[model samples]
Target chain A: MASPDAAAPPPTEPERWRDLDMLLSRPGNLVHSTFDPSPVLRDLIGSYVEVLVVGAGGLGCELLKDLALSGFKNLHVIDMDTIDVSNLNRQFLFRIQDVGKPKAEVAAKRVMERVSGVNIVPHFCRIEDKELEFYNQFQIIVLGLDSIEARSYINSVACGFLEYDADDKPVQETVKPMVDGGTEGFKGHARVIIPGTTPCFECNIWLFPPQVKFPLCTLAETPRTAAHCIEYAHLIKWDEVHSGKPFDADDTEHMQWIYSEALKRAELFGISGVTYSLTQGVVKNIIPAIASTNAIISAACALEALKLVSGCSKSVSNYLTYNGLVGTHIKVTEFVRDTDCLVCGPGTLIELDTTSTLSEFIKMLEEHPKLLMSKASVTHGGNNLYMQSPEVLEQMTRPNLSIPMFELLKGTPFATVHVSGMAESNGKKVSSLRKLRVAFKGVEEASKMDTTESS
Target chain B: MINLFKIKGQKKEEAANSNGGPPVKKQSPGELRLHKDIAELNLPKTTKISFPNGKDDLMNFEATLRPDEGYYLGGSFTFTFQVSPAYPHEAPKVKCKTKVYHPNIDLEGNVCLNILREDWKPVLNINTIIYGLNLLFSQPNDEDPLNHEAAAVLRDNPQKFQRNVQMAMSGGYVDNTHFPRGGGGGGGGGPCYVLCFWLAPPTLAPNANHCTI
Candidate 1:
């Protein structure tokens, strides 16, 4: 939003920025080694540091407000989900009128309206829909995602940008820091993932517990618990009765039918505790979200983003867990990075002749002892060199298979090529994505020769 | 330490069994599912289920199959099932107690059944799995075989495969792999019969041996 008067000069130290100025202007022992105590640091945070909030849900709303008030001006938020009445409890930025509107747009507008001078751009699209270059534009990415799959996807995307040098050391400039915050009921966690320095989400994927699943037999036959009954109604009975029609959990009629069915099953089996709300919870797999928890978690995430960009203090070693349930418990755990991490690490390096064709490289990959990839779909820097699936895509990219490897890779000496195909893992065929560092034999020498000729 | 815990558990079960209408302890969803599945079971005349740990401990049971028709006819194969509390959600751990020559079942009693692995859905009950196991005996799929040699023989030479099955069932060695005598006369009974019952601790170890029928 533009200021009402163009001639009006910006406030030197507004009351809203007083708290932020105190931290940035003062000299402190905890500040980063490269940190310079100056007013310019405040300006850097106010206008220069571009931060992207990955979700516009519970924590997203809080993050936008916190970051804006912390003197961050350039903020972008992306979310595919629209605002729902159910999200009103914790997602305060959205109102009853804004129910069907895109969460990112509503959240951005609300935050911008409340906090003047803070520019918030909203992208109401899936995270995967955005190109790799789109993610690279932001200085820092703050994730407020709830789904593990989404977190993993964004984590891989962030780590995908990291570049390593000749010595296998990660280039600091290429490290796109991510502050991840998650809340479930009264429990929450905030983690700073410096792609190359700290463990990426994939490295510590074991931290997430596997989803709870009830066997179909149990639901169909003997449902001992209320949840089993609900799941029975939702999973089996709905499909049997509906036949061709798919059960939409969001549909009021569909949910009502499920609830009634669940109640009847519970009654038949002498089971109790099948409520309408409980049925919704079971079908949607809703995690109890407390507003206070979101605020607390988002605050931690926003502070980390500030510390990372401004070098105000060392980022919380790596992870922080908060439990406000029984009393209040907060713990910080430091996690180490995996050097051989397929996502973050410089992948297995392969030297190729400049004249080698894409099809020839695929043949070499199959024969290569380290990577026996069959029917490999190759992509270099988001460019589809060749795709193995979806007949149409495969047909479109088929012509590129005859193109020279260097030409497909833009004649770059060192490039990361992602090849996905069926590979044997633990004696079983599994689809695997392998990142390979391709070094063209003569490209580096040719570039050096060009420099010499120009000089 | 585990034995002590087992003893304490056994004492509790004994108390509940003596007082029995139903056990004072609530049945888990898995146990309830197993009970319903067992109650509604339409087992083939050749198949029989037995609660080795008695009816009180339904989670751990045995199913003995005497294939009346097929290459495995007159040969009894027993499998022990250890159902978890998470049953219906998770597949029951079924292990073949009696080993015999088969393309789909390995020497270690690991049956290569699709439903028991990735294809297992909650809607599938104990009956479906038993039927799948029975089908394995009758058809002996060579495409997704566990015993590679047996699969190769079955695929390439039928007479040799028949000889291997006969030799293995009658307690002989085929290609250096010894098989105990499992074949008796083919037995038939009414469907859905519990052939045997024996009281054992809930923590009864799965014995890798044939059922004493």
Candidate 2:
């Protein structure tokens, strides 16, 4: 691609993307004039560079078009969403015919058909469905998602890509740069996250205010509102009726059941305004998103992505906030990166006993307050300490789960184990990959601890 | 006037006595939290609430505010608070029923309060919004004002604006225009008040004998 020797018709919309070529032709670019005299270095950035755009909603559609028009030839968009009639007002790439169709596939197809010489690969699946290897191919990952949990999940995955030397310093080569854009009403923000260098999403976790919580007494003694009834059904009645099965918000039957139970409670309480939409909103914690805001934020995200990929100029120095409400107030703030960040920095250190087996360690991971990992696959120094997938790997690792913790550590004082699993975040099941530093202690300490606890 | 604080307690007692569908009716987290907020409501003495429809309509109600101190002292302004089923999670839709010559309050009665809009968070209870509104009367923010004219006047000429406010409050002429004593109608007095205290023949109305509005 750098040579432009392979005969692929001259890049379409050459005039439209002429400035982008000028950017790559600058001395700072990797494929700049030092090596080749041909324009392939400029062209190589387009065809060879792999960029993954996560989410295919309003902002996602804008990112696809913006990235395509910016001369990004290899683009991949992944979204586990269908085109709903509600999405039409802002998601410009979709239409009435596209309703019920996978947003990623349709968005990709529409962008390809509209923008010439740009190829987009669409993955119509959840981000968790794809393995770490699937994400490794992308040079830059752009996030246009509305869900905070989803953003954190991706952020954790990006940080999980980090590898440390013997001195416990993050290797720069393994760092993944992520550009995230979020819009709420006329307010939006675009943040550049080069894990270990800039603040990862988790570093500013407090930036997102806490979710709404209700008192159990109010829920039990006095239910006055429709939300009360919905919560009653969701939290209490569901458990009362279906004991073992977890309540799935996406399941139509489960939702309808909740709605009916809520309506009954509402009627009994003499409360009104319990609509289906409201039920879904309360259950899912849905935010009302506006279109133009999405477009503005997504444009910033895409531009930042381009800047990251092409060294066009200094990227948005960490974070950019846009407010269209009060006469278009845009503020760029450089948030201080957290040095003790669990995702980007050295992980939480846990002291373990040599007598503790891998089986006990797995149980400990599930019980740990900070981790609370319901499911986990452990990796130690790039080796599969344990895997729950691909039956053969699981079989091979199952034996290791019973082995002594000292055997796994193999004379090491401390071992960094990577755990990938799902955690209950914001009341939603979100995939999280974390690095855990385990220091093995003597067998006497283990037996002493067990005796003290048991006694 | 509906005592909203007692509304939930009575409802629970009534449900307990009735032919119950289930032994226990569950409440939403938001509802439970809002109930706590209502129980802990420390409303100012100047404020009062009444459900125009009924106590059953806790989701919608009318709240009257009497500014005890400010340029709007002795003036009573009413607002409607529509609590969505989402309650604490969603900010209640609050709109002034009687318009006033305030910088933060628009001519159409739309208020310029941060808690009701972008700055709203789940932790912000109705009490917070009440305090916010009360603060607006005492110290209105002219910078982010919805009523630009009022804001300009308040910013440039405080004394003249105070005179005009006093004049308008007493059902008298400030410049060349006269305002009805009870309601706010300098320019933007929309006809949305289908029923209110403004129904009485105003002192400023010349054709009050024949006019229905």
Candidate 3:
């Protein structure tokens, strides 16, 4: 008989994760083609995998709960918004007392208190404040972001880590997977993005509708609706009354002043329904967040993340949308990636010596047969290495031109640089951003750094 | 050749200086648009633009309109224009500095021009507004009026409205409302042809002075 000490530790509450264990341990016919079922697969999720939850609002709160209960033990959440009295209805994890606190911190604390054996780290800062290395640490990223800008930023960060061989095929090991979910009123969408394999956020950016803007004349003069009145007070009157004083949407006093002024304007215009809450909604551009919609979307996102990590089932084909306005309607669409996508596809590869200066690089870009750029503004990993405009930025980054490329890049032997310049398209000079993969020769051991397949 | 980079740099410096103190403010899109609008302003010969607070302060200015032929003909009216920094987006607030007995111009000096109110558009610039104000003098619409009494008089009796305007231009009283002396004399002793033109009110005459330039 095996010694008791050598035996595997007893499973804690064997029934607690019975459903998850079943899915991970015994695969069904619908499982992914690469899926290999085993009891160890369940243990991998609890022990090794690290998932990042990128928001702590409505969908974010539900995602934390769903992911925690689904055997993802290590989780991190980041949010820049503080909880408000208005967030109480949909953001379930936050209570009345938690108002004025960071949504991430409060949500993390609440989720940890409810779920056992789960560790959640909260980052109470903007997503832009974090370093690229911080994002690279996560095995899977689950997004519950509201804005297109934030989604695009994180998507670029994940895609920034992708690499390709000489054949322009993405290296499987370098692809960072992301599951994104968003809810607006009774509509929501859940999408799975495997950086290089699937269409990234930027590829289908047109899916989002442009924001509605009231004509300035309507808001200033006519003001037929209550919204026009609120917009008038928020956009025009506030500036005219307080010249030099910027209206902070977050400040209570400023909001109160706008609300009162809007109310007065509404009364003058004989338009009703101008409330303080409505004023905040208009000023902040708040989307009507429905809790049930968030719940459904977050569940979909969590399942996609699980399928991606454990290979228990085939993930949703790129994108899934839900509409609950009239009746429950759900659909999944297999979206294709853009072949010439600037964000995902491997950029034009350039080989150069480590001793090449930044000025030489700019000149090379202009003279390169494929690039043929007129004037270049270069950035690496979101940091501006050299800029060619605005005079101030150009002057500040001018000194970098004299420094060696490797010295500017510091530790990395190879990195992707994003360059914006005037390039000829259809015989006309058009400004566009071109991604370039720059590899410095003789900087490190060539054999160890060689990633391109000879075949 | 226009150096866009150099012009942008100078604009940045000007924006910083105009911002006065502390925070170095960048030139906002609104300011840039306003600058273009002001540069492209095409005013009529009947109208004149002046910066009351000097050239540096473009936000506040005054415009004087000398109508050559209309009910308010030969009457030079000054309007104080307080333009918000949100120009073109928000119509400039204009108040008549010279009081007159007209259907659109109220006792409170509010001029009720459609473009200045409900019909305003961002594409309509200071030039369009100046032309609209001049049009108000040439063809005063009695349909929508801030001064209800004057509108009723203009609608009920055209001749009575003409006499009242002539009395108001000569610093006389009509219906107990006192009027200030205007720019040019439209008194009984003026050019006989001018008085004859006043009788017609030159409703649709090709009066180049007030015609849309």
Best by DockQ: 3
lDDT of 3 by residue, A138-235 (tens): 77899999877678778877887788987788876567899999988999999999877889986776555445665443454467888999987886
lDDT digits (tens) for residues A1-455 of candidate 1:
55343445545547767877888889898887766667766675665567899999999999999998887899999999988888997788887889999999999998887778889999999987886667866778999998876787788778877888877788876788899999999999999998878899877764565467654334544478999999978865664465437688778999999999999999999998999999999999997889999999999999898888777787898999999999999999998876656667677677899999999999988878777778777765435567664333456678898899988776667777767676666767666667688989988898778867976
Per-residue lDDT of B116 in model 3: 61
Docking class of 1: incorrect
Error of 2 at B87 (Å): 25
True contacts kept of each: 0.00, 0.00, 0.00
lDDT of 2 by residue, A1-455 (tens): 34222344545576767776666555554431233223554476565577899999988999999888876889999999998887888898887878999999999998887777789999999987886667766778999988766787788777767766646676755777899998888899999998878899877865776456443223433677888788867765675466346799978799999999999999989999898888888998877778889888888887787666655556778899999987989999999887756567777566687788888888888778777876677766434567654333456678888898778767555565666666555677666556677877674466557757975
Candidate 1, B1-213: lDDT as tens digits: 011133335446555644222111222334444544654466787787776653346578778899988788879988889887556666787766676677766554555565565455666778788887787777775554446678779889989999989998898888886777874322112111011111111234532111121
Each candidate's interface RMSD (Å, one decimal) is 23.6, 26.3, 17.5
Ranking by DockQ: 3, 1, 2
Q: What overall lDDT goes with each candidate model? A: 0.74, 0.68, 0.73
Candidate 1: list runs displaced more than 4 Å: A1-13, A357-414, A418-434, A444-455, B1-213
* Candidate achieving the largest lDDT: 1
